[model samples]
Target: MASPAAAAPSTRSVRLQIPRAHRGLRDGIEAWLEAERDQIVLWAPVAFGGGIAIWFLLPDARGWLSAMLSCVAVGLGGMATGTGGRLARILAIGGLLCAGGIALVWWRADRVAAPVLARPVVVAFTATVERVEPLAARDRVRLTLLPDAGAGLPRRVRVNLATGDAPVGAGEGARIGLRARLMPPPAAAVPGAHDFARVAWFAGIGATGRGFAPVTVIAPGAGQGGLRTRLTAHITSRLDGSRGGIAAALATGDEGAIASVDSEAMRRAGLAHLLSVSGLHITAVVAATMLLVLRLLALSPWLAIRLRLPLVAAAAGALAAIGYTLLTGSQVPTIRSCVASLLVLVALTMGREAMTLRLVAAGAMIVLLAWPEALVGASFQLSFAAIAAIVALHEHPAVQDWFAPREEGWGLRLVRGLGSLLLTGLVVEAALMPIAVYHFHKAGLYGAAANIVAIPLTTFVVMPLDAAALLFDTVGLGAPLWWLTDLALQILLGLAHLVANAPGASVALPSMPVAAFGTMVAGGLWLALWRTRVRWFGWLPLAVGASWAVLTPAPDLLVTGDGRHLAVRVDGGLALLRDRAGDYTRTMLAENGGIDGEPALLADQAAARCTPDACAVDVRAEGRAWRVLATRSGYPVAWRTLVAACRSADIVVSERRLPRGCIPRWLKLDAAMLRTTGGVAVTFAGGRVRTVRTPGDRHPWLVPATVMPFRVARFDGGREVRRRALQRRRD
Candidate 1:
């Protein structure tokens, strides 16, 4: 038998091995739990289903469906890997097969439906105005058509019309006939430009129309009887003459009352968002309403308890927010914010943790389901991105540390406020830069600075006063509020002018290449979602964008088409020709092609300048050099010598073509034409030519065959050299 000591050592080793095995098993179980935690549940699955449905319903939906289904397959694979053994293999194979089946069904449905869906047709119909606004120079109106007019497409149409003599209101229904052109909304304007068509499609618009010519309102009757419309009209009508117009515009999205010039000034000043009812505005209004209601409830403890005061107040605030959203015409972005806020509120009321990511996803799902096209809109993209970024930033450990421990004293508070503003401005500006460049071809370099001053003013002073004015107007004492609003407007306008005038304030950037823009967006998303040092790599796009802006070429020519003057690029120098004597032509020429250099006058007698071989003349160059006949009183010898040197010049460079003299090739006096024979001719109405032709075609060669009226010649080594009168001496 083995010794007792030897047996003891072996038993100890076995016991140690058992504990290690147990520990490994526990670790594996914890990981499995974590993975399960990450899995989609509840609303996530619903959203996933909606995405799948959209993929199935839209054209080219099979690809999108395949991509989404692949994610499911990936999850299954990940699960199987952790399970190991025979069970894992079986699970993987089964999961893949299930995914394949679903994909096949989607594909089959799409193929079958593709032929059955009729290509939308253009037809005349009556439509009710859902939303209307001015875009560029045209009026863009979204209208819902009558359902049973036998137009089997959809209930809505986006109309781009000339804002005619009639003033249109949102709730008004019109009995006007117009042609509806039906087509799929474009994906984007210039690759990365927001796709409005996709947005319109999801909003239930199958067609777009132009004009109110065939469109006439049936009556000024209340079109859609909604609480939102009623509130909008009420607020707008009451705040009509008040400076609270901007406030009402911001609160209710009634921009019609806001003057165009004022609106533009606010935008340039970086206070444009204040005028729109966005997430920030909605949150503020809700918070304010909740506080007021809570304070009232707190005053009566018994009533508060009986009414479930907090919950009741929250519900009221929710209703108010919804009404506000509708009053603001319920734009996709506004509605998205409303839904997102409501989700957060409901989560709070139910005592469930409302994760930022979850709320964002829910909001996205709502928007996509309602208007699948909104996924491509700028307002949708920027609003969501800004919100998501703000949420992420607030959650960041570094940011939390800096802000969580409140600063004491006024000086410290001011420092904190300024720091917060700077950080927020930087993040939002960075987030929106790429999209702004893509759409506008210009980036506000000083936008961060503008926001630093404007955001605080707009939020703290402008919005509050406007809101107060609206409230006061509802009663009858609106004058004070209106005056304050006017003062705020003036301050805003001043800030806009100051910022707009700043050096390098607005830099015109070249439109980004589609691939580059897509890459940048992907990089940005990675930076936001991924937590690592690699996030810094997102700056690569900024670098690339800067380089592109620096390298963009200038336009070849800039013309005003007013027929005042012509600026021609001749031999790398700009030549100015004024049709009439005035400073306008000279000033315009100086600014042509955005060149801000000294004006070199070619026609003014006192400032006339030219190259050694060329001369300036008051008379225009008309006919071909060989055919220009000099007047009898001036340059007779030079004229005879010029005509003798050439015989075939039959062209006339003039403002008006003369019927006499073989009807020569008439070149317009103000036009710049590049002749194949290596010479350029500027002409006048009297058939005068100031031709600059070099010895060879490479240098500027003149072909002479018909006739030359004025010339001076010199013979050097058997080669005849001729110099024509580029200038006409007055008789």
Candidate 2:
């Protein structure tokens, strides 16, 4: 009924509304960019780490190189045009940092490239022990051996030696000859699991094996393990068994000495960090050294006035930190903490506050540059997250106001200190939650409370006692100190077991998506780094990430890398198709399914119709039943049985490759197929099976194309080149 002119006005208004909304969004973004000019520098590590992550995701070096080049080109172009505003400049810097990160990690990987073992073979050689690391099994020790150059093997090879047959005390610089069957390092057990082969590759280790023949000591080099070994022996001898193991670990960074049962208890109760020599240990060492040396120097007033006491004391602390780090094996986490502690000493010399987010970022950049591969490691992630969160919380304006010292009674002061400790623990736990969930697939509910007591006990009570024991052992009076250390460790171990036994100590969460993890990291960094009110907006991404992590369903089916083990979801729990799977395999599969316990055997289930050669079962998922038929026998099966299973089942699995006549309705997995995929995880979404394969391509340390250790792809003169098959290394 309205006139055409009235309708034209209404349409015009609607069109104008869109532009107005667009304009508002643009203006808001511009304001945010402007406000964050100073804060954006803090994101350099994030940008750098992003590029490193992308390199790992791509299958080949060319893809990563091409991407890196593209980023550089885009960054340069952006820099040229960034005269417009701070936003443009920020984008340009981000691009360059990302390119730099990718380039650095790629260079590192290439530099560490070594020849991989082509096949399993028995070999005997006299090799020097480069390093000796303790394993969870007390009888086993991991030895890095430098084989003779004529052997045509990689520079370093790791072997797990049994104490029964191997040398009694193998340590650094010892030469030994042994015959062992060596094989290439292995891939993950299932899709989305940790890849030890890739880690081994970056460590310049191409082969791993267990010593089968008795180890013969060919030549014992000069004082192998030296002072560190003697110290470890003294600690362990004073406090034997698990107590000694914990003490030795804290003193010498020999974590493998800890009993597996106690380690698991500590891990589940969230006190495992105490076993690792990292920030807290390094901090205590540096602080105690500085204080003691400063007091001694201050006793002489003449020297105190002549020399800058703080600088002199800081120098002493720096030396102690470096020495302690080396004594403790110079591991990645310990080195990271050492670097940060040294930075604090540097700050002290310059009369500046050291505990800042900037310091954390700077230390990360250094570590990323030196050991770029560590960026993806759990130790790097957890250590950095905890320290960064604490520093951020310490610097918060609100926290500062609430924690300010006031004229109050001892009771009020003690209460305030306890409250502060509780708050810091909560903040650290929250910051580490996403990372823990991503890597471990579980979240410890009482980790904050556990840390409140364990951290102080380890840092204050136990470390000092352990150190005193070491000092007094030279005079043979360390028994008392060692006794005290043992008592404290017993209390610590008791707390670990008690907390681990509590109901809901840790809740298994579904496997996390990479996107969700990245989002959470961005959100956390944003919330921690920025001081403006706008920082509160970071909760949006955090909430989004938490939701995504919670909603991502567990895999319905998992196949092991060796094609011998198959786990399927059934009756709201996981079930192994066979009972032959090892404990490690069973635990990994359960973790993949977000289940707390090992999988039940399918053959033992009441409804599963399984024979000596085959197993057929029905699993309900996404509101429909899926029929899965899998072979049981390793030998050949009846042709008619295979055909029947393939025809009737929704999915089919076989130990041997299927014939053309055997086709399934949905999916099929056989030995031949599994060889290429390494491992496979199948999930149902919207009534469709979604497959996730690991080591998806031949990436240096993954699936072998031929009998060679693995198929490695590389770029040569802008063209993909192939390597001829290698012959036997020891003919």
Tens-place lDDT per residue, model 1, 1-731, is 98888667676788889868777766765555345333223134233333444443333435555655675676487575774543344445444444543454344433322111123344455555554443321234344554223444345555566446234433445454455554433323111233444344334444454444546565444544355445444554544433435655666676655655565455544556666678877887777778889898889979966787879878978987897787777887799889988997898799887547558767866676555435545677778777767776776789878876574998887888788778977888778777666555545666677888877677778777867876787788977976787788667667876876667665444334445555566566646643455557766865675556445432222222222233433323344543333554444343332333334444443323333222222222233122221111112334343333222233322221222322323432212322221123222334323322222322000111111112212234232222233232222
lDDT of 1: 0.51
TM-score of 2: 0.90
Colliding residue pairs in candidate 2 = none
What local lDDT score does residue 570 receive in model 2, on the 0 to 100 scale? 80
TM-score of each: 0.59, 0.90
Question: Where does model 2 exceed 4 Å of error?
Answer: 1-34, 82-84, 658-660, 685-698, 703-731
Model 2's alpha-carbon lDDT is 0.80
lDDT of each: 0.51, 0.80
